[model samples]
Target: MSKIKLRPKSPVRLVATLTFLLISLQIASIIGQYLAHQFSIHRAIDVVERRISLDSAFLDVGNETLNTPANRYAIERYLERLEKVLEEKNLPVVVSEIQGVRTKSDLTEFPRLHRTTFENAEQTISISINSRNPLNEVGISWLSIILALLISPLFAFTSKKRRAQSAREEIVLPPKPRLVINLQEKTISNGIDDKVVTLQNKPLCFYTALVKYCIDNPNESLPPHKDVPHELMALANKCFGRLIELGHTKRKRPDFNANLDKTLSEIRAALDDVFTGYIDEKETYYPPRAQGEGSRSKQHSYALPSIKEDDIEIIGN
Candidate 1:
């Protein structure tokens, strides 16, 4: 019997897991540091408050009506003793900003810790605990961790949704070919597929004129038979005149209105030849055909509705 080995399919999952774990560990480390610093400060504050409440001088000061020099000296001596006791317990904090008498230890420049206010009938003595280490101060580390935790899952959800949407999408098809007409070369082409068809002088001029009219008046359609518009006729004559100027044809411009139907048929045949494999695109480039048993009196329009004005490029026009 042969053993079959199973391997993981995508490295993306593994990378994502590793990245998440790394971020979580970093956040946890920051939270742990902040908590540890808070616990130490709390312990130090508890010790100082307990010692202050037991002092006989602080109790006596509560009943005093005046904050005399002797009372201030007594409060100052009590704070010095409290500081010494905190130092013995390995707490790096000192009391400062008392009412009157200054202490030998001045830690005014350090980060202040929370302390209780001692108030008498005459004066209030509010002491501030200044810690030597800056890390004892409250910082934005906890706030940053909370924001990261909140935003990480949101980012992950959005990325997951995008991937699922992309997976459900179908393969995109190639863009349709543009219709290109070159009067200089007397050739019509499907710009994308390299399919080219050359037309005779009259048919080419008539087709170019029709394309130009469609570009200017996209919503309007020309009538079938010899009911060609005057503007269209003038444009056709202009194209024929350009051909004569270029020496492509020596014959004079023919009457476009008289030979309208024949010229339309010729244009359709040339377009069909150019788009041989792409027969479905005939409606885009071909002249509109008569529909559903229509008589000569009925309004049978000739137009290229599917082709946008920007898609049809007429060179040497």
Candidate 2:
């Protein structure tokens, strides 16, 4: 405790720290000088602005009028208006003096018109505020803010109405149309004719009205079916020319004709079932094979395939 001693700081660290502190101080001084220079320039600009005003004095417009309190009041008002009018111009307008207090007269190159007047005071002045009125298509400039004020209400009313009417409305639905369908015949154009081929100046559907008519009058000496590949092919060709006629795109079942003939035979047999007189009853009971007194046997039913008129033979019967 009695021999406690303090160690000296390193010279290298002390020198480095001093160098950093000096550099920081120099940088701060430079920044301060730059800020001062900016401040001085801003002050100079302010002084220059103080020298001139943005508004202008009124000018004379009329020559035959007199100077009165009313006329003076008009001049002051004209100056205020001129100040407003000057705002729109690139080169600012500074009114000098209002002269010729009388009727509003024309002035050159300025929105306001004025003339020297004589009626009351030793010096009388008159001015005409620009009537930036829309005369036909031409417009006259004005210095007054009354128009701007008046239009604000119209804008506010429109805005409020627009806001109020912005709500969305639900759509109303209508009744559905009636629909009809047929299997044997097609009444609609979309049911057939995949290639949209027309026949007889109309689109040909396999089950369409024209096909039904053909079937109704098959013996009417029209196109035949055997030469054509399919049943619907002849119908399609009848509707549109052969060049544009759409064909039947179908996978004909294996031995389709044989199967169809077999089906037709079965149907013909069924129809011929009513022609039982063709068979002899005594021979139909059974053949002479395995004859017995108490014998049982199946009935031998027979029928013939249907024959068209062309296939029929003119016999003695």
Instruction: Estimate the TM-score of every prediction.
Output: 0.56, 0.17
Instruction: Please write out the lDDT profile of model 1 over residues 1-317, one tens digit for every residue.
Output: 64434444355755575567557766676677777766786777777655654564444343335434445667777777877887788775666635434567767544665556765445555556666564544344555556665655543423444455687785577777678999899999988777789999989998898888777787886667447788888898999999988789998788787767788888989888888877786578888778785524257778765667767888887
TM-score of 1: 0.56
Worst 10 residues of 1 by lDDT: 59-68
Q: lDDT per prediction?
A: 0.71, 0.32
Model 2 C-alpha lDDT per residue in residues 189-223, reported as the tens digit of each score: 12222211122212223223223333444433222
For residue 288, model 1's alpha carbon misses the true position, in angstroms, by: 1.5
Report model 2's TM-score to 2 decimal places. 0.17
